[model samples]
Every structure is written in C-alpha cells, then in structure tokens.
Target chain A: MTAKQNTQNSLPQTIFRRKLPKLLLSLFRSVFLLGVGFVMLYPVLFMTSESFKTVSDTFDPTVIWIPSSFQLYNFKMAFDLMNYGQALINTVTILIPSVILQVASCLFISYGFARFKVRGINFFFGLLIFSIIVPVQSYMIPLYVNLQSMHLLNTSWQFYLQALLGTGIRSGLYIFILRQFFKNLPKELEEAAYIDGCNPFFTFLYVTMPNVKPAILTITVFSVVWYYNDYVLSGMLLNDHFPLSVTLTGVSTALNNQLQNMAGQTLGADIKLLSDAILAAACLIVVLPLISLYLVVQRYFTEGVERTGIVG
Target chain B: MAASTEQKTKNKPKRLRSLEKQQRSWGWLFLSPWLVGITLFFVLPMFQSVLYSFSKILITDNGFELESVGFKNYLYFFTESTTFGPYLTETIWQIIPSVLMILAFSTVIALVLKSNFFGRSLARAVFFFPVIIASGVVITILKDQVMMSGSSVSDMSPSYLFQAPDLVNTFSQLGIPDQLLSSITTILNQIFDLTWKSGVQILLLLAAVNNIPGSFYEVADMEGATAWEKFWKITFPTISPTMLVVITYTIIDSFTDYGNLIMQMLQDYYRNNNYAYSATIGVIYFVCILLVIGLVNLICRKFIFYASE
Candidate 1:
C-alpha cells in the first residue's frame, strides 16, 4: 500500500512542479496586459458611449458605459458649431509642407553627421542633442519675436521656414534617430559607390538614401502625426487662421457662448447639461481620422522601428 | 606625448590629408542648411534670450530696446516668488515616480507584446493607442475633465474608470492601516497619468527587446533557465542602453508635459506680456532641466551595461 501511494503521489507532484509556475506566469501576463489595455482603451470607449447619450441620460447615474438611447444630436451640434471643415483644411495645408520639408532636411543633416567626421562635428552634434533636451519655451520669446519681425506669423511661411531648415517640431530628435541608423550601416557600400566614380552626393542619393527608405517613412509618419497634433507653436504663429488643434482646445469655452446665442434654439439649459457629451463627440471627430491612419500604417510603423538603431 | 602626436600629424601622407580635406568640405556642404538653422534660430535666439533675461525690454518702433535692469527679473523668481520653490520641487518629484512607472509598465507591456499570443497584433496596436492621443485635443479634454475634480462630468470621465479601485472604502471595513490606504490612493491617482505616457517608451523598448540576439535566449532555454531568470541574466543587461534612453525620454516628456507647473507659469507670464520675466523663467527652467539630465546621466553611467563592441 505504501509503495503504491508513493508512486501515485510522486507522479502528480512532478507534473505540478513542472507546470504550475509556468502556467501562472502566462496567466499573469495575459491578465496584466489586458487590464492595462482596458485602461488605455477605456477613454475611447467612454467617449464613444458618452457621445451617443441623450441629454437626459447624462444626468442619470444609472446610464454608465451604455446609454439609454443612441442619438446623433451631439455629433450634429459639434460639427456645425466647431466649423470642422475649415479647421481641417488649415491643418492639412501646414501639415503637408511641414512634414515634407521636415523629413527632407533632417535626412540630409543626419546623413552628414553620420557619414562625415568634419572639424567641430562633435560640438555640433552635442548642440543638436542639447537643443533636444532644452525646453522650446526657453527659446520661444526670441524665436517668436524674430519670426514676428520677419512677418512670418499668421502665414504658412512660418511653418515652411522652420521645416525647410530642419528645425520644425522635434526635428532634433528625428535627426538623431536617422543618424543612429546611418552610423550602423556598412561603410563598404558607400566606398564601393565612390570607387565606381560616384561622388559623395550621388552616392548618398543612390546608394545610401535607398537603404534608409523605411526610416524615411518612419520619420514622415511621425512628422505627420506630430504636426497634426501640434498646438503650441502653431497657436503662437497662426493666430488668425486657427488649426484643428487650437480650435479644439478652446471649443468648450466657445461652445458655452455660441450655444447661448445659437440660431433658432434655446439650448441654454440643454447645452449646459449636454456640454460633456458634445465635447466627446467633437473629440472623436478630431481623433478618428488619426486613428484610422494608425490602423492602416501601424504595420510599417512597427517594422520601421525595428530597423532603426534605437536599440543596443 | 603632445610633441609625438604633432610629429605624427606632420608626417601624415598626402592622399589621406586630401581625403580629410575633401570630407571636411563635403560634410559642411551636407550640413549647411542645418548649420544655418542653428546659427539663426537656435544659437542667436539663445544668446538674445540670455541677454533679455538680464534686462528690461520696451517694445518700440525699431525692434524694441533693452535697458539694463541688473537681475531684477531673476531676483523676483529666485527670492520673491512664493510658488517658484514648491513648483521646482514638485517638477523634480514628479519625474521620479512618473519615469519609474513608465519604464516598468512599458518594459512589461513590450515583453508581453513581443510574445506570440491570441490577438497579438491587436494587442500591439492597442498598446500604441496612447501615442495617438498623447499630445493633442483629446488628451487636453481628458486632462481637463480630471482637473475639474468632483463634478459629475469628471466622475463619469475616464478618470473614474481608472479610479475603480476604491480599496480604501472596502479595506476600511476590515480596519487596514490609514497610511497604506493613502499610498494606494496616491498610486491610483498616478495610474492614468503615468500609463498614458508609456506608449512611446513601449515602442522604443519593444525595439530594444527585438534587437537582442536570439542566441542568448536559445542558450538560456537550453540551460533550462526559467523566463524570469533568463530575463534578468540575458535580457536586462542587453537592453540597458535602451533603458537609459527610455528613462531620459520619459523624464524630458514629464518636464515638458502640458500639466507641468513651471511650463504653465512660463506660458502664463508670456501671455501676460511679461517678456523679461518669462525669459528669466525660461532660463531658470532650462537650467533645472540641464541639472536633472546631468544627474541622471551620472547615475546611469555606473550601471548601464553595453554589449561587447
């Protein structure tokens, strides 16, 4: 009896020892990631659900997560009140030119830093990184005043000037990323191009630039998204024709005044009551385009990140 | 040693010297646009800002005039301002927990995402969701809702969802310690704040983890090392450089975040047309950032491991 019991117990005990911790760890990872993912997801879900709520549903505490009735009223109000179309056009104009110039200039500059070790290059590189860490707010006064003097404020020229020079919105960081990628590349390829009677410029254009196409795409996507979301500099410069971001920022306060004197409606009470829901709808309209863009390009996004020298 | 180096340089071959000269010119040619940008937009502005910080300026017809104020703007911020000291300390305090939590969460999430699992692509995209909402209108609205505190709207927003862990009320019934409860509340407060900022950090870390050579993991597997043990021995050391990068990125993000008090104050002063004081504030704020980053690098230098070159 003792021998039989020992054999049975040892078999199960060994299986348990081998499997339990591994199983637990896998379970823990899934649960932990899902929990955090849910939190990351909650705002989107909350806003969507809230945007669909009737004016009365907001007042009722029972109406959480899911609303009593689905309504397009908030969205209609948001679209008309926010002047969505004009703001989007303004955003696109600056965004396209900025992203194009930002990518092109940064590409050239980073390649130079990576390929050529000129006199004072290290000092320049240090300054580049220093600029990255320094808050733009510190330098904004002088830059802003100078730009104003140039009559660049409230014009697309301001955006173009910064981008053309490779100083547009976090361009320092972009230069750094591209430089890292360039440094890790094999020296033989550029040398071979040179040996084949290609000058350094042609070598960069043909041999080197093609090699970093994925990185260029990465920079382009980042530039687009950052330009789309930018508020600070754009707000400062484009005071007359506001972008989507600047418009959205002051939407709440603007809504309060606008709805009060709105055409043919006494939404004074209802607007106050439904302000949060309307804001939610407006947020979605602004955010949805970028979300769709992400869904389309995230594969290249991750792939590009993998190829960069952001790693050990 | 210096004389020997000078002799060696003097005796260098003609072809190599010509190549060096060619490279010097080419490098400058490639970097010309950026060099101009730095000189005009960066270095010049920086110098002017320093000068502005030291004096009073009156806007006029001919590009304004500066009058020497003898550190009055600097003195006000340093000695007289009541909020300055607290704001400075709070900014530094904010970085510690925010950076640690961001680093910890991003590392764990990136690890989990790296593994093959059900709906792994979806999970990866979901992890990057915050990066989409990081800077713009949506985050501002969300942050505003939280800042509104105690309103019904605030309670219903995502902050409430994040604050679902009302363990204080639940545990109070069982008579748990008050101090632990407050700490728990503090962590719950930071959850929404820290977690959203982890998106870019996660992206960088995932790349770092991917760049780790497969052979190390395979060797660890063959040796029967558990996942946790393998992570510490193989993964952590390998990813230390990226960890430093992530930490620096996180600290910088926090310092420049929309909610930062110093930033708010600086903007406030700028908006109020107090240019000199604002410039002074900007300079001081920049110094604080420099000191913090310098400190972080010094600390990281001791422990940051680099794979054999």
Candidate 2:
C-alpha cells in the first residue's frame, strides 16, 4: 500500500483519486480506536472480573482473564460487608440535597452576574475566579475549625452545605461552567419577557432557564456523578458513617483481612461460591447505575462542554 | 427628532418607574444565597487563615487559644529553614510532569475524539469518566495498585505506553546506541507517558474541541486550507483560552495530591493542633496558585477569541 494510493488518506486530494485507501483508513482507525477503548475500559473490566471470582481466584494471576466457575457469593459478601443498603441511602441522601442546593446557588449567583450591573460586580467576579484558583487546602484549616465550632461534624448537612453553598468553592469547576453558560444567553429573550411585564425572577425561570436546559442537565449529571463518587468530602465530614465509597473502602479492607485466613488453600467450593456471589452482587448494585447514567448523558456531556468553550 | 426624543423620555419614565427601586433591591435576591454562603464560609475563613498564619496554636486549659507570634511562623518556612523547601520542590517537580503529560495526552485524545468516527462519543465518555471517578481516595487506591513502592507520584510510568526497559530493548534491537536511545526514550516517555490519571483533562479538552465553531473550519475548508493549517489557524486560537485554564487547573489539581499541602494540613490540624504551620503552608500554596492562575489569565487574554465581540 503506497502512501499515495492508501485509501485511508482523509486528505482532499485522495477523496476523488482513490477509494481503497479510505477503506483501509477506516479499518485502521477502527482497530486503533478499539485498542484504545479496551485500554480505557481496563479498570472497569478488571473490577468486574474480580467481582465474579472466588476469593481464592482473585489473586491467582493465571485465572484472572476468565473465571473457572462463576461464583455469585462475592457480591453477597461485599453487600453485607459494606452495609450496601445503608450506604446507598446515605449516598442518595447526601447527593440529592447537595446537588439541589448547588444548582440553586449556581443559578442565583450566575444570574446576578449575568443580568445586572451590581456595584462592585468586577470585584465579585474576581473573587469568584480567585476562589476557583485557590486550592481547597487554603481554607481547610479554617473551614474545619469553623465546622467544628458549629458542631456540624458527622452530619449530612455539613456535606450538603459545604458542597451546596459558595463556601466550599472546591467545585469551582461548576461555578465557572454556570457563569459561562449565563453569559452566553441573549439579552433579547429576557427583554422580551420584560416587555410582557414579567419580573426578573419569572423571566429567568420562564425564559433563560428553558433555553439553558442542556446546561442544567449537564450540570445535574456532573453533580450527581461527583457527589455519588465522592469519598473525600464525605470522609472529611461524615467521618465514616456509611458514605458509599467509604463503605467500599471498609468492605475492601475487611475482605483483605478475610483473605489472610483462606491463603494457600484451594477454597472449599461452598465458601468460594458464596464470596463470589456476594462480590458480584455488590459490584452490580454500585456500578450499574453509574454506567447507565454515563451512557445516557455521555453525548450531552461532551456537547455541552464544547459549547461552554472548554476545548480549543 | 424632537418629538421622538420627547416620546422616548415619556416611554422610558413609565418603564423605569415601576422597576427602578425594585430592580436595585432585587439584584440581591438573585445573588443573596451565594453572597451569604461566601460571607459565612468563604470570606471569613479566608481572612482568618491569613491572620492565623502569624499566630501559634496554644493548647492551654483554655481549649485551642491562639498566641500572636508575629512573623515567626512565616519566617520558619521562608528563612529559618524547615523541611518545607525540599517538600515544596519535590511537590512542584511532581506537579510539572503530571500536568504536562495530562495536557499533551488530553489534547491528542481530544483531537482524535473530535474527528468524525464511529464510537467517538463512547471513547470520550470512557476518557471523561476518570475525571469524575478520580477523587483523592480513588487515586490512592489506583496508586496502591499501579505505582511502584517508595517512589511517590514523582516517579511516573508513562501511561498506556511501553515501560523504559521494553522501549530500550526495542531500540537496541534496532541497532540504536544505548545512550542516544535512552535520551530519546526519556523525552518520548516524558511526552507520551501520562500517568493514566488524566480523565479530567480529557473531559476539558473534549469540551474545548466542541466549543470551536464549525463555521471557522468551514471557512478554512472553503479557502482550500490543509487540515494542519485549519488547526493552527482556527482550532488553536479558539481553544487556547481553555488550554490555559485546563493547564492551570491541572497544575493546581496536582498540588492537591494526598501527601501535599491539603492532606498535610488536614492531618496536622486535627492531630497536633498546629494551625500556624498549616496556615503558613496554606498561604504559600495560595500564593503559588494565584501566581499560576495569574500567568494563565495573562496568556489567555492574548489569545482568547470572543466570537460575540
């Protein structure tokens, strides 16, 4: 396949001159993409494989790619060990409230910046950007002190407020994103609403909000993913009371301890089967929703981000 | 013209009469929640942290009193010589390669994903999922699994690429000099090896690519420009602002590693009641961040294209 005649060439010159190279190009591209795709999927695949394997099989290098026998007990064990039910509830409890507050806060803040010429507006904007740039560590000392003083330790509200408010601007990414979205809205839409005698609040909700549905959804999905997968803030605030990721850590450690007892023995079939089932069940419960959501919003997420001027 | 100006004034007064006072008052309504949250959580703590940097934590019978120590704490870090300098340097060195690799890899992957291809969206999601999942604990678990023991994150293995020995062996088999091959391998490894933890950058890059106007590319195509030319002219400028942002983000994000400033402060603050040291480090880190973000802003102002403008 000469370079000149390679059908894989996407250049304009070859478009009219050759067809074979295009076919070859597409073939090469698919293969390359599939290879990279597999690499990207490696972690999830490994986790899935580990979830189905018996306790003994998990560490065995040779048996990794395929399980000798499907054991479903691992999922059950993981579930019980992690207190999956409580953690799931706790996760939803924290995620829903936090995301709601964050959405509201972002809207109000960004709307003010976008819609009005408030005094010291530039100062406020600079403060917001500065807040984003300043690492969370900068305020951790004081925030921890303040939270302790407020006696909000181990409380769900602590997580909610920290995540929800402008306080823990750690999610400056979200704030920045919302600000950009608000700025891009046409003033004409709001002006038309004003002409019809709609107040600012009603106008924002009825006009601007409807138009930025895609941005809202994108932010909602991002907040969900961030909050659901969140362990750090949960760890910092919740102090290990059944946050989902915290529960996973707890269960993994417990399982590590249990592994020591079963070492060097081909596990008796019953125990192995039980452990495998438990692990599988836990992985399914934890990962299924996230993967499904990922698939659903995957396109919107990319498209929304691109419109926000994220990539050049 | 005079009659129209009188009509405009009359119409404007009616429009303004109902809304002027309400508008001035209601601007706070739109901004109040954020303003209150910031005042309570952001404004107070930030200034307090700055003040706390100059004071020593006293563990007297009075629980957690602060004794004003002037610039002693800051001096200890800046001039009196603590382990801070070496740790700062080590952390900075770790941040540089990690951030650079993330930028390069994300740029390449974003470019590839942006091209018309089957399963492009899936590829983007796979790459972006890591950003959402790669929190502190997740990174800790990943590090435990992948990183060699005793080498902190400073010792990065190029991600999704061959390790040094394999690359060296391949080059040697091809009759290349060991020294020459080694340097080339080193550079390539630095450039190509991304630490496999760049999900955030990938997402940001994908966003940047999506933001590039199709009209710019269409015009370039009409002008008979090459693909390379189109990228350099249209794609690069439009996305340069984001690159600055993401790069600054990656740099600052790197500093938030578990062993660095944030985690260190958390541990020391809780365990030893050392607010002064923590505050000092926090200020230093904040200043470093401000400097980096300032640089990024300066760079961005030069190249950020505003289509509306």
Best by lDDT: 1
CAPRI-style class, candidate 2: acceptable
lDDT of 1 by residue, A175-239 (tens): 88777667656677788887788988889998888877666876787788889999888887777
Best prediction by DockQ: 1
What are the Cα lDDT values of the candidates?
A: 0.80, 0.66
RMSD of each: 3.8, 6.7
What's each prediction's TM-score?
0.89, 0.79
Clashing pairs in 1: none
Chain A TM-score by candidate, in order = 0.86, 0.77
Please give the range of 10 consecutive residues that has the lowest summed lDDT in model 1 chain B: B145-154
lDDT of 2 at A183: 61
For model 2, how does the per-residue alpha-carbon lDDT over A1-312 read when each residue is reduced to its tens digit? 686565456576555557667788778877876766665666556556656765555444457457778876666666677777788888888778888887766776678876676667778777777676565655666776788889987788786776666544355666666666566555776778888999998988878787666567666776777777766556666665666777765554576567557754845534433343344445455766677877887776777665543222
> Chain B vs. true chain B: TM-score for each candidate?
0.85, 0.74
**TM-score of candidate 2 on Cα atoms, chains taken together:** 0.79
Docking class of 1: medium
lDDT score, candidate 1 = 0.80
